[model samples]
Target: LRRQDLKAARESIQAVLKVAPDFGYAQQLAGAIEYEAGALAQAVTHLTRAQQLMPESLAARQLLAQALLRAGDPAKALATLQPVLDGKAVTPALLNLAAQAWQQQGELAKAEALFKRAAALDPADSRTRVALALNQIARGDASALESLQATAADDKGTVADLALVNERMRRREFDAALQAIAALEKKTPGQALAPLLRARVQMALKQPDKARQSLEQAAQAEPANLQAATALAEFDVRDKQFDAARKRFDALLKADPKNVGALLAVARVRQAAGAPAAEVRTLLEEALRANPTEPRPRLALVEHHLAQKDTPAALTAAQEAVAAIPDNPTLLAELARVQAVAGDFNQSISSLGQVAAQRPDSVQAQLMLAEVQMAAKNFDAAVTALQRARALAPRDFTVAQRLAAAQVAAGRPEQALATARALQKEKETAVPGLVLEGDVEAAQRRGREALAAYRAALAKVPASTAVAVKVHGALLAQEPAAAPAFATKWMSEHPQDAGFLFHLSEVAGARGDHAQAEARLQEALKLRPDDPVMLNNLAYMQVLLKRPGAVATAEKANQLRPQHPYFMDTLAVALGAEKQFDRAIELQKKVVALDPKNPLWKLTLARLYLDAGQRAQARTELSALAALG
Candidate 1:
């Protein structure tokens, strides 16, 4: 008590009690020690026994009650203090303790009454008034705060104004908070707490540049204001600059390694930047160690495990998360998705049902249930589930597409057609719409109508390679007679286009004009000789025409794309005809190797082998061919 080393005093007294076993002086000292040490539970145990031994001691009874109040055992504290409070006025210290405990227990009237009584008992004490003002604000009693502010204004002290301004800041009324801080500064210029409050107000207003200036001033004014530095670090995070934010947080952490806020801020910044998930996991794990009760790190750890596709680790994380946030629908939904992927579908279904009950209109939940139903061959149920999902997300293309597919499978093509048609109509009129009209006509089996759709598509976008090809194919289906003219015109219009040249050559060959076909193919080769499709096209056409020097041309195509099945097959055909049977067999073997299921390659390979007098190899190839399809 003399030295005021509460921890040392408690340890020494406890040591004495341990040795002596019945030392009243040591026990009394322990009570005194723990009350000052703020270990209220330990202090209450020591003080209760000490009060029994020293029965008429007012100091022991007061200390015991205050310790009980600090420990949040307010009923016990109230009983201890009732004798002192009833039929008697209380001291400032005893009232402060009783009010603190009552406030913690949510008994605002009793707390505020004690605070008022304490301030009246010590009218000259600014500290008691500051405590009373804080309690008033806590109770939302604005009148008490007004009384305190007037009392502080009447009093001549910077500390009271500083404390009053801080109370305004705690209320998060930044404008009013700023006015209070300005008042404090006007009263006593360049005070530390006012500048700190001004920085906090600037940060709340999202004026980072101003906040930084204010924080710099606060940190300079009171070098111990660690909160200003922490706030500045968060400002960099608000600006989405992680490297700068990380630097600031790391600098703070370097000076005080146990700063949990700095550590947590760094982790949050990394998470926002999509840093490789392992880094995020490491950060959360470290933060969790500092604050085991915090839900954020545990939840983030679950998300990280999911991202890495470690299902078992994810499950453990999710279980911890659900325990922390038992009613969170998002947590339950994510957990169910993990369970489903790991083949625990029953658990997944139960979890999803809970989420569905909580959020019946959730399109994602309904869609997931429908997909699971479809996988389990419950097609009718899947269709019903999808209908609900579609209603929730009426404009969702995926829901519409899947719903149509399910209808078609359930022998409802007309319904499928109707849904597709409705979607097509919406796209045609909707602003910022995306319509593929060809899909609509194709679904209805109207190839000719699809041709018209593609033609219209071309009118809107003439340079679209895919649309031109689509329209050209549709036009050739039943109007081969019109194709040659269209092909000629198209080739003339786009002279450098190899696809148009290929189409033109096909049209010429169909008309039995071999010379014209050859001229077009030559022109295509001149433009892009080594282009894979062009090379394959030329080689195949040469083989079809039985043209002289076909082997040389096919050889060149093969050299450019050795493993291409079409070029390899063409070279095989060319080689076999030239009586280079062994070379032809090798090329044919490669084609079969590339596409084992393509029996055409096996048949060709066998023929080449037979011509090479390799009957065993030929028979093997023939057997492979016989096994296919």
Candidate 2:
């Protein structure tokens, strides 16, 4: 041994092999130690001995593979990981290693797919997701979200782990979750997730001291577990013991100098203390070099880019991450949202659909998919998604809201009201539902009953936005001036909130006070520049007034976000006014792309094509439209 540490190293590694005979790292290190001591034949003997003890050992196989590779046998190296890959319950980590080997073997597509499969197998595996997303982008799938969401949703194991953890935390069942985690600890004794998860559960259950104690133990067990160590450090930081946290990380780095989690966490702590972006980026780069598949540092980079309005750069980062981790639902879903905002509905829908398919129980994905469908006028699909969401979470208010809208659009407003009423009855103990009952009454034209319902709601519930909005909107028909004054008084008492402002704007708009309406709209736009309905209304008003640049503004609104189908009809008008007949037809194509079930956009496109002298294309489009209808 050049370092003359052979006896000590042999003893340490021998002890590991005794318990974990097939341990790849140990056998590979032992073989390498022998090789470095000018003992190639001896190295082969040690590796051969390891192969006998652990035929499934990647370390032994890898050492032999490399031994063969060095002796001009690349083919053998390529075949070395078969046993590991063929093992049951092949975790994403092992899959990642196998994929790297595949890449080395020049099987690009197989490599990419395996990376994606790995990502799908482990949704929380940030590294695998980033790698898959990056590879997907390389394949010219600029819509990286499509693959990312698909992978994330297609997990092979329990997909409800996060929700389970959250639910258990809510119930203060930290001990139960920890009991499950003990199995994880036994399998990966020094893995950071075991104790960090236990600590998080403890913290959520309001046992701060216990949480701190668990983190301390985790740090002791796994010095490279930055999650646990950093969490403890943050508490120390709050206690003005930043030096303690720093010293802990420093000592950890001495052991695992390339520990990405510790480096990234340490850099983040520095950044929060007003360190330079250059410093943060440097640390992020170092972490990424240590683990290229990780998405966390890249996500931080995306945030910084977004803050600077460098959307294209942010999109690029998202695209790279999605490529590497096709199964990462969050990255994929967010990428879809970014694309949607960038005027790519078809891409967005594809991504949203993938997310829904993979995670049928994801209320967020369901709601988002439904909303996207509503924009495209796929009312049936929207309703279907909302129904699924209702099934998953019967008590979620957001699901109720979407279901109500879908019902209205699907020519089932009566059913919508019924559904809302049923939900309301279930919540009669709460003031909000009683008030919502008033809305149902108003929808049925039972104004007097609606007023009674409102009063009932007010009796129990404090004066709030929902109540005021309902009260003013319902009361205005019978008592105009009095209603306006009351509405204004309530609005004055609660300024700067969007829901109230929307109501006040609607009131002004209904009164034919265009100036006042425009002013309110401007204020609302300041709060939400991307409000599609407001944008459409403002564009329509501008168009009617023959205002300059109305066409450009209308087009911008259409391109930027989902609008009511009414806006598409309005956009058709805007396009015709601007004499962009051909472009108008393509915009109509977009409408159809948003909702293939809707025939309106198809008819519009067919007519526009005929007017533009594309008779053959027009005929084909007309035939499709007829078939669609």
> Which residue runs of candidate 1 sit more than 4 Å off their true CA positions?
1-436, 478-481, 503-520, 555-562, 613-616, 627-629
Instruction: Give candidate 2 regions above 4 Å deviation.
Output: 1-227, 236-248, 251-254, 257-260, 276-282, 295-300, 373-381, 405-415, 425-629
RMSD of each: 21.3, 19.2
Instruction: Give candidate 1's total backbone clashes.
Output: 0
Alpha-carbon RMSD, candidate 1? 21.3
Report the lDDT of model 1 for residue 418.
64
TM-score of each: 0.36, 0.43
Residue pairs that clash (backbone atoms under 3 angstroms), model 1: none
lDDT of 1 by residue, 535-588 (tens): 666666666677777788877776555446777898888888888887888778
